[model samples]
Target: MKIKNRTLLLPLAAVLCVAALTGCTRTSYAIQTNDARTIISDGKPKEADSGLLEYTDANGVKQQISKTEVKQVTELPK
Candidate 1:
Protein backbone atom coordinates (compact mmCIF):
# COMPACT_ATOMS: atom_id res chain seq x y z
CA MET A 1 0.00 0.00 0.00
CA LYS A 2 2.88 2.38 0.77
CA ILE A 3 4.54 1.77 -2.63
CA LYS A 4 1.25 2.29 -4.46
CA ASN A 5 0.63 5.59 -2.70
CA ARG A 6 4.13 6.81 -3.50
CA THR A 7 3.72 6.06 -7.21
CA LEU A 8 0.47 8.02 -7.37
CA LEU A 9 1.87 10.94 -5.45
CA LEU A 10 4.91 11.25 -7.70
CA PRO A 11 2.86 11.72 -10.86
CA LEU A 12 0.48 14.05 -9.11
CA ALA A 13 3.36 16.16 -7.88
CA ALA A 14 4.85 16.39 -11.35
CA VAL A 15 1.56 17.49 -12.86
CA LEU A 16 1.05 20.10 -10.17
CA CYS A 17 4.53 21.50 -10.75
CA VAL A 18 3.97 21.80 -14.46
CA ALA A 19 0.64 23.55 -13.94
CA ALA A 20 2.13 26.01 -11.50
CA LEU A 21 4.96 26.91 -13.87
CA THR A 22 2.65 27.42 -16.83
CA GLY A 23 0.16 29.44 -14.83
CA CYS A 24 2.80 32.04 -14.10
CA THR A 25 2.97 33.01 -17.77
CA ARG A 26 0.42 35.64 -18.73
CA THR A 27 0.93 38.23 -21.51
CA SER A 28 -1.03 41.43 -21.30
CA TYR A 29 -0.93 44.78 -23.09
CA ALA A 30 -2.07 48.28 -22.26
CA ILE A 31 -3.59 50.92 -24.49
CA GLN A 32 -3.80 54.41 -23.09
CA THR A 33 -6.70 56.49 -24.37
CA ASN A 34 -6.69 60.18 -25.06
CA ASP A 35 -8.92 60.69 -22.02
CA ALA A 36 -6.24 59.05 -19.75
CA ARG A 37 -8.15 55.77 -19.39
CA THR A 38 -6.07 52.65 -19.98
CA ILE A 39 -7.41 49.51 -21.65
CA ILE A 40 -5.87 46.22 -20.71
CA SER A 41 -5.79 43.88 -23.71
CA ASP A 42 -4.79 40.24 -24.12
CA GLY A 43 -2.01 40.63 -26.68
CA LYS A 44 -0.04 43.11 -28.70
CA PRO A 45 -1.56 45.44 -31.22
CA LYS A 46 -0.98 45.37 -34.98
CA GLU A 47 -0.44 48.46 -37.04
CA ALA A 48 -3.25 48.63 -39.54
CA ASP A 49 -2.49 52.02 -40.97
CA SER A 50 -1.00 55.36 -40.11
CA GLY A 51 -4.14 56.16 -38.18
CA LEU A 52 -5.46 52.74 -37.19
CA LEU A 53 -4.42 49.95 -34.80
CA GLU A 54 -5.76 46.45 -34.40
CA TYR A 55 -5.59 43.81 -31.67
CA THR A 56 -7.45 40.92 -30.10
CA ASP A 57 -9.22 41.11 -26.77
CA ALA A 58 -9.35 38.64 -23.87
CA ASN A 59 -12.41 37.04 -25.44
CA GLY A 60 -10.42 36.06 -28.58
CA VAL A 61 -12.28 38.55 -30.76
CA LYS A 62 -10.57 40.88 -33.18
CA GLN A 63 -10.89 44.64 -32.72
CA GLN A 64 -9.67 47.85 -34.27
CA ILE A 65 -9.23 51.38 -33.02
CA SER A 66 -7.98 54.63 -34.34
CA LYS A 67 -4.54 55.85 -33.43
CA THR A 68 -5.90 59.31 -32.76
CA GLU A 69 -7.95 57.84 -29.91
CA VAL A 70 -4.87 56.39 -28.21
CA LYS A 71 -2.39 58.37 -26.20
CA GLN A 72 0.19 55.64 -25.72
CA VAL A 73 0.79 51.89 -26.03
CA THR A 74 2.78 49.59 -23.77
CA GLU A 75 3.21 45.97 -22.75
CA LEU A 76 2.32 44.85 -19.25
CA PRO A 77 4.66 42.66 -17.21
CA LYS A 78 4.23 38.91 -17.17
Candidate 2:
Protein backbone atom coordinates (compact mmCIF):
# COMPACT_ATOMS: atom_id res chain seq x y z
CA MET A 1 0.00 0.00 0.00
CA LYS A 2 2.75 2.45 0.91
CA ILE A 3 4.71 1.74 -2.26
CA LYS A 4 1.67 2.24 -4.48
CA ASN A 5 0.76 5.47 -2.72
CA ARG A 6 4.29 6.81 -3.09
CA THR A 7 4.33 6.15 -6.79
CA LEU A 8 0.96 7.78 -7.26
CA LEU A 9 2.09 10.88 -5.37
CA LEU A 10 5.34 11.22 -7.30
CA PRO A 11 3.72 12.28 -10.56
CA LEU A 12 1.28 14.52 -8.74
CA ALA A 13 4.10 16.19 -6.90
CA ALA A 14 6.01 16.76 -10.12
CA VAL A 15 2.99 18.29 -11.81
CA LEU A 16 2.40 20.61 -8.90
CA CYS A 17 6.02 21.69 -8.84
CA VAL A 18 6.02 22.52 -12.54
CA ALA A 19 2.81 24.42 -12.24
CA ALA A 20 4.14 26.41 -9.30
CA LEU A 21 7.31 27.40 -11.11
CA THR A 22 5.68 28.25 -14.41
CA GLY A 23 2.82 30.15 -12.87
CA CYS A 24 5.14 32.44 -10.93
CA THR A 25 6.74 33.89 -14.06
CA ARG A 26 5.15 37.00 -15.53
CA THR A 27 6.23 40.17 -17.33
CA SER A 28 5.44 43.36 -15.48
CA TYR A 29 4.71 46.67 -17.19
CA ALA A 30 4.00 50.04 -15.68
CA ILE A 31 1.55 52.43 -17.29
CA GLN A 32 1.47 55.97 -16.07
CA THR A 33 -1.70 57.96 -16.62
CA ASN A 34 -2.07 61.68 -16.95
CA ASP A 35 -4.12 61.67 -13.79
CA ALA A 36 -0.97 60.68 -11.81
CA ARG A 37 -2.16 57.09 -11.26
CA THR A 38 -0.17 54.09 -12.39
CA ILE A 39 -1.54 50.82 -13.71
CA ILE A 40 0.17 47.46 -13.67
CA SER A 41 0.07 45.10 -16.60
CA ASP A 42 1.42 41.67 -17.46
CA GLY A 43 2.40 42.77 -20.96
CA LYS A 44 3.31 45.88 -22.91
CA PRO A 45 0.38 48.04 -23.81
CA LYS A 46 -0.48 48.26 -27.47
CA GLU A 47 -2.36 50.73 -29.54
CA ALA A 48 -5.91 49.65 -30.04
CA ASP A 49 -8.71 50.92 -32.20
CA SER A 50 -10.47 54.15 -31.34
CA GLY A 51 -7.26 55.57 -29.99
CA LEU A 52 -7.07 53.24 -27.00
CA LEU A 53 -4.22 51.58 -25.20
CA GLU A 54 -4.81 47.91 -24.63
CA TYR A 55 -3.08 45.40 -22.37
CA THR A 56 -3.59 42.45 -20.11
CA ASP A 57 -3.38 43.55 -16.51
CA ALA A 58 -1.55 41.87 -13.64
CA ASN A 59 -4.75 40.16 -12.57
CA GLY A 60 -5.09 38.70 -16.10
CA VAL A 61 -7.93 40.97 -17.03
CA LYS A 62 -8.09 42.64 -20.45
CA GLN A 63 -8.09 46.41 -20.15
CA GLN A 64 -8.23 49.41 -22.40
CA ILE A 65 -7.96 53.10 -21.76
CA SER A 66 -7.93 56.12 -23.97
CA LYS A 67 -4.50 56.70 -25.48
CA THR A 68 -4.69 60.35 -24.60
CA GLU A 69 -5.11 59.46 -20.94
CA VAL A 70 -1.81 57.59 -20.81
CA LYS A 71 1.34 59.55 -20.10
CA GLN A 72 3.86 56.77 -20.55
CA VAL A 73 4.24 53.01 -20.75
CA THR A 74 7.35 51.22 -19.60
CA GLU A 75 8.38 47.68 -18.80
CA LEU A 76 9.41 47.11 -15.21
CA PRO A 77 12.82 45.60 -14.41
CA LYS A 78 12.85 41.92 -13.67
Candidate 3:
Protein backbone atom coordinates (compact mmCIF):
# COMPACT_ATOMS: atom_id res chain seq x y z
CA MET A 1 0.00 0.00 0.00
CA LYS A 2 2.78 2.47 0.86
CA ILE A 3 4.71 1.79 -2.36
CA LYS A 4 1.62 2.27 -4.50
CA ASN A 5 0.84 5.60 -2.86
CA ARG A 6 4.43 6.84 -3.34
CA THR A 7 4.39 6.02 -7.03
CA LEU A 8 1.17 7.93 -7.56
CA LEU A 9 2.48 10.88 -5.53
CA LEU A 10 5.57 11.23 -7.75
CA PRO A 11 3.60 11.73 -10.94
CA LEU A 12 1.13 14.01 -9.22
CA ALA A 13 3.92 16.21 -7.97
CA ALA A 14 5.50 16.39 -11.40
CA VAL A 15 2.24 17.45 -13.01
CA LEU A 16 1.61 20.12 -10.40
CA CYS A 17 5.11 21.50 -10.87
CA VAL A 18 4.67 21.73 -14.62
CA ALA A 19 1.36 23.47 -14.26
CA ALA A 20 2.76 26.00 -11.82
CA LEU A 21 5.68 26.84 -14.11
CA THR A 22 3.48 27.26 -17.15
CA GLY A 23 0.99 29.35 -15.25
CA CYS A 24 3.71 31.87 -14.46
CA THR A 25 4.67 32.13 -18.13
CA ARG A 26 2.95 34.84 -20.15
CA THR A 27 2.75 35.15 -23.95
CA SER A 28 3.48 38.38 -25.80
CA TYR A 29 1.31 39.58 -28.66
CA ALA A 30 1.63 41.75 -31.74
CA ILE A 31 -1.22 44.20 -32.38
CA GLN A 32 -1.62 45.55 -35.88
CA THR A 33 -3.69 48.53 -36.87
CA ASN A 34 -5.25 49.68 -40.09
CA ASP A 35 -2.82 52.58 -40.25
CA ALA A 36 0.16 50.19 -40.50
CA ARG A 37 1.18 50.52 -36.89
CA THR A 38 2.35 47.59 -34.77
CA ILE A 39 2.30 47.36 -31.01
CA ILE A 40 3.87 44.66 -28.92
CA SER A 41 2.39 43.87 -25.54
CA ASP A 42 3.34 41.60 -22.69
CA GLY A 43 0.08 39.69 -22.68
CA LYS A 44 -3.15 39.40 -24.63
CA PRO A 45 -4.82 42.70 -25.40
CA LYS A 46 -8.23 43.15 -23.83
CA GLU A 47 -10.97 45.68 -24.26
CA ALA A 48 -11.18 48.05 -21.38
CA ASP A 49 -14.36 48.80 -19.49
CA SER A 50 -14.47 52.00 -21.51
CA GLY A 51 -14.53 50.01 -24.77
CA LEU A 52 -10.90 50.54 -25.71
CA LEU A 53 -8.18 47.96 -26.31
CA GLU A 54 -5.81 48.71 -23.46
CA TYR A 55 -2.33 47.25 -22.95
CA THR A 56 1.25 48.08 -22.06
CA ASP A 57 3.68 48.38 -24.94
CA ALA A 58 7.13 46.80 -25.07
CA ASN A 59 8.54 50.24 -24.34
CA GLY A 60 6.66 50.15 -21.01
CA VAL A 61 4.14 52.75 -22.11
CA LYS A 62 0.46 52.42 -21.27
CA GLN A 63 -1.73 52.69 -24.35
CA GLN A 64 -5.46 52.70 -24.91
CA ILE A 65 -6.62 52.30 -28.49
CA SER A 66 -10.09 52.06 -29.87
CA LYS A 67 -11.36 48.85 -31.43
CA THR A 68 -12.14 50.65 -34.66
CA GLU A 69 -8.46 51.47 -35.08
CA VAL A 70 -7.28 47.88 -34.64
CA LYS A 71 -6.93 45.60 -37.66
CA GLN A 72 -5.75 42.39 -35.99
CA VAL A 73 -4.14 40.87 -32.92
CA THR A 74 -1.64 38.01 -33.20
CA GLU A 75 0.10 35.96 -30.55
CA LEU A 76 3.91 35.97 -30.80
CA PRO A 77 5.81 32.71 -30.44
CA LYS A 78 7.99 32.23 -27.38
TM-score (all chains, Cα) for each model: 0.64, 0.66, 0.64
Candidate 1 stretches greater than 4 Å from native: 1-26
lDDT (CA) for every model shown? Answer: 0.86, 0.90, 0.91
Candidate 1's TM-score: 0.64
lDDT of 2: 0.90
Query: Largest TM-score belongs to which candidate?
Result: 2
User: Candidate 1, 3: how far from true, in Å?
Assistant: 6.4
Identify the leading candidate in terms of lDDT. 3
Local distance difference test, candidate 3: 0.91
Q: What ranking of all candidate models by lDDT puts the best one first? A: 3, 2, 1
How good is model 3 by TM-score?
A: 0.64
Off by over 4 Å in 3: 1-23
State in Å the error of residue 24, model 3. Answer: 3.3
Tens digits of lDDT, candidate 3, 7-72: 999999999999999999888999999999998998888898887999888876888899999999
RMSD of 1: 3.5
